[model samples]
Target: MKILFMLRDPFYEAYPTFIEAARELGEVETLYPDRGIEKAEIIKEIANTDILVVAKVKIDKEVIDAGARLKYIIKYGAGYDNIDIDYAYEKGIAVTNSPGQNAESVADNVFGLMLATSRNITKKDHEMKSNHWELSVGHEIYMKKIGIIGFGAIGKAVAKRAMGFSMEAIAYGHYLDPLAAKELNVRFVTLEELLTTSDYIIISTSLTEKNKGLINQNTIRLMKRSAYIINVSRGGLINEVDLMEALNQKQIKGAGLDVFSAEPPQNALPLLDNVVATPHIGGATYEALVRMADVTMTNIKRYLAGEELLYRVYPQEVRK
Candidate 1:
């Protein structure tokens, strides 16, 4: 069997176990596409691949068809929206992700974004660089109404951190864990209530068809003018154009985005002000990368040995 790695940067080192196991599985090839390549490029390079290891790359039907021998696909992180899971399933290809690998790092990064947005950290730093001594008064996150949209491991971590800051936390999800929510003191509320009542909205939901544009203009219109929204989840959860319009029209106080609809947009949008845009670095910490790689390799080895995987992504349990 052969394994192909379609990765973003060439700097990631494969886990030691994966390197050792690859010797028994023939050669391991890697494909690096241009940042702006079309679907044809992806399809072309996936030819003859068996197992495809991907990271933030789109694996549409055409690309799937190109990999005639593909038996499995492993995403580096938790989100597998980049892959066409339906097609992969129909073709008998198992799709997996390294969940819990980036949970702690993403939880910490979420708060970092929240604090930076609320305290105007980026803006103050820029002003001070220009020799301005005047202090810009920013809102304090303490005692603020924080609405978390999802209640997964990452969401629980974020809620706990918010409690430490004395923020009142609430959440909305398809299936609520009452015991977990009660333990964390997160109020279970309707999505509408979460939208209108929160002073700071932190989106921690996974991406699915139902949640693709959950944060559209209608939802944005419901938020308080003093509210700020943070998204460490998948980019499609919020409509980018609507978010930009809201920020530009002053409909919302501010936003902290770690993901975007089209990553590395053609040009900077006007929402740059009163908004902190990160290049999807929620799980980019060195510690997270190492841990995620180890988890990914473990899953691969288990699958090869015909054993059960620890961090598997079951098709039925997928967010979509």
Candidate 2:
């Protein structure tokens, strides 16, 4: 395994012992955070890679084809949209991801963002620091109706956390079973109801073909004028252009976004004062880093032993 890590930055002391073990198995190299490299350079660097590992970088068909000896791709988190999965499948390259590894960490970030926007915490802190102490009344989140999209591990965790705040949590999914909804302690609702009813709506779903740009002008109109949105899922979930127009028009209250349609957005997201945006770091905690690495190691051991890889992504239908 000639492992190549296409990571933005070092994760959790670089997971020292894991690196040592992988080094024993085969050669390992990383294209780290600070250095700037073009796609052509990236293609050149991965020419001999047998196992390509990544966190945030996009691995298109060009990069996959450039890796003449590529065998496997291990995404550090649950989402695999950054990779051209069909092309890699055609090339016979195995694609895997670390699901549920970062669930708790991401849930924490969702709450953090939620509180920040709802209470105007960041704005208040800025005002106090600048010696301008005008009282700015913020909304209380207690007993508020919260709607969570995509009732997966992260959504369930968000629901559990919402209980501590005394908030009512409802969830919406396309094919949610009644028993599963009962177990999660969330009442199932339609997408339209969730959007219209919730005081705070959290996007915790993955980006699928049907749901990309799901939160558009018409859906935004369905929301209450004072309602807020918290997105910790994929960037493509919301339409940035429509969101910007709504923000300027005061159609909705505000947003706390951890992801964007285009990373380092080339649009009006940064210009809005009401929007609190982070660099897509919903699950960048040290715990998440270690857990994902552990899961990846399990897959590597399976690959070496001629066993089925856990959290395999490509072919999407094969699950055991």
Pick by lDDT: which candidate is best? 2
Residue-level lDDT for 54 in candidate 1: 88
Query: Model-by-model lDDT, in order?
Result: 0.82, 0.86
lDDT of 1: 0.82
lDDT of 2 by residue, 1-320 (tens): 68887776657355767777778778888776446668887798899988888887889988998999999999988988889888898899999999888899989998888888878888888899999888776788888999999888798889888888888889998657567567656898899999999999999998988899999999999999999989999889998899899988989989999999887788878568788888888888888888988898888888878899997785545432
Scanning candidate 1 in windows of ten residues, the lowest lDDT window is 10-19
**Superposed model 2: Cα runs more than 4 Å off:** 12-14, 175-177, 316-320
Model 1 per-residue lDDT tens digits across residues 1-320? 67777665632453445445565666687666434557676676677777788888888888888987888889988888888888888888888887767888898988888889888898888789999877777888889999999988788888889889898999999868888898989999999999999998988888988789999999999999999999999878988888888888999999998988877654455258899878788888778777877776777778788887675555555545
Point out where model 1 deviates above 4 Å. Answer: 10-26, 33-41, 314-320
- Structure candidate 2, residue pairs in collision: none
Worst 10 residues of 2 by lDDT: 311-320
